[model samples]
Target: MSTLIAIAITTGILSGLWGWVAVSLGLLSWAGFLGCTTYFASPTDGLKGIGLSIATNLSGVFWAMVIIKLSSMVSLEIIGYVITAIVAFFMCAQAKKNWLNFIPGTFIGSCATFASNGNWQLVIPSLILGVVFAYAMKTSGLWLKEKLEADKLVEVRKN
Candidate 1:
């Protein structure tokens, strides 16, 4: 598990670095991508954020493409958005890796991209950063827990 996690982090770091390069070169917009990435990357014990973010973002990309292609078929714009939301919800609810958190993850990824002018390219890096940072957050929490427990042990011994 540790080795797999380390690899995941390494992959995210490499992808995020490339995203930075793209931003610096003016090849991409950094605003929405970075913002969404940071918000979703919040670290926790089980890396749930990263998992959910990845799944949601990937689905968001697909939905964005579909909406772009299909929205014109409908006379009502709101219907298109509703259709998207329903499909997104269904997908999120079905995701096995993140079934528990699928709702927020799907909404965040889909709505964020939907609002970002349907730029899945920009969404990719944000997803990477979000996933990697989630790992970092989990690791930090574990380390902090260990240190606090050690401190309690020391205090008990001194008494």
Candidate 2:
């Protein structure tokens, strides 16, 4: 539980910081950076999870700026993305899921920002892709867990 909370706080802070930077630089929002960073920060264990947590949280701060760039809706974007990400992270962590948890927020944040920019072209695609990615991650994580368990069982039998 503590770990999950840490992840949410970390992701949110990163998101906000990135948002601020994006807004300052006149970038359309930090969605691209957010996505890239999330993928990069995927946790393999305690050490990697710590680093990824820091990176992911800070990336979310950038989403605030993304909202600003897309619709001049800084507050909405911040609230929407931050709340969703925090909640999703906690829930998914408790459920022991991985990147699957972040998909909804990413999709919503991306689509919302793009939709505000009058770029309807990207909204649907982003949402669809997010869902697909989430599904993939969920399945993969479960598969890996199963394999690990099976390996452990084999070792125990041999012992």
Candidate 3:
């Protein structure tokens, strides 16, 4: 199975399991973010992919809180774009290495903050939980793949 598909299934289960929790804690609100981040971060850099995503998730949440707080001082409807640009620029500047796709991943995580109406307190926890779940889902997927497809390549090539 594809890693992304496995992630989707894992998070869906988690979401259904956590429906009683608030939006911020529910996987339904975060599975997409986690899947996209894992997809972009897992392409290369091997073990470092998870580390890169961890940093991106945390940074994304922090920038989100910054934007949300700034929303109180100005028009988020407009200033939100400006803040997004600045944050994107800042994140891209430091992403010259394996994390070149970090911007999109962070955007996914950061946007979750506003969507959930979450505060800074949830940033660290959310990021941490996301990273942990993403990793666990990925590893479990690889294990399942190896176990089930021990003899088949199972590679899907599109031309």
The per-model lDDT (C-alpha) reads: 0.58, 0.43, 0.60
What is the C-alpha local distance difference test score of candidate 3?
0.60
- Tens-place lDDT per residue, model 2, 1-159, is 233454444445555555575567544343434343444345433334333333333333334344444444445656767655665454335323353334434444444444446343343333223333333343445555666678889999999
In model 2, which regions exceed 4 Å deviation?
1-116
- Evaluated with TM-score, which candidate comes out highest? 3
Per-residue alpha-carbon lDDT of candidate 3 for residues 108-129, written as tens digits (9 for 90 to 100): 6676666768654654555555
Where does candidate 2 have its weakest 10-residue lDDT segment? 123-132
What is candidate 1's lDDT per residue for 80-122, written digit by digit as tens? Answer: 8887777766666666654335445555566656766877777
Decide which is better by TM-score, 2 or 3: 3
Would you list the rank order by lDDT, best first? 3, 1, 2
Task: Enumerate clash totals for all models, in the order shown.
Answer: 0, 21, 0
Model 1, which residues run further than 4 Å from truth?
1-49, 72-101
Q: State the displacement of the C-alpha of residue 119, model 2, in Å, after optimal TM-score superposition.
A: 0.8
Q: What is the C-alpha RMSD of each candidate to the true structure, in Å?
A: 7.8, 13.8, 6.9
How would the candidate models be sorted by TM-score, starting from the highest?
Answer: 3, 1, 2
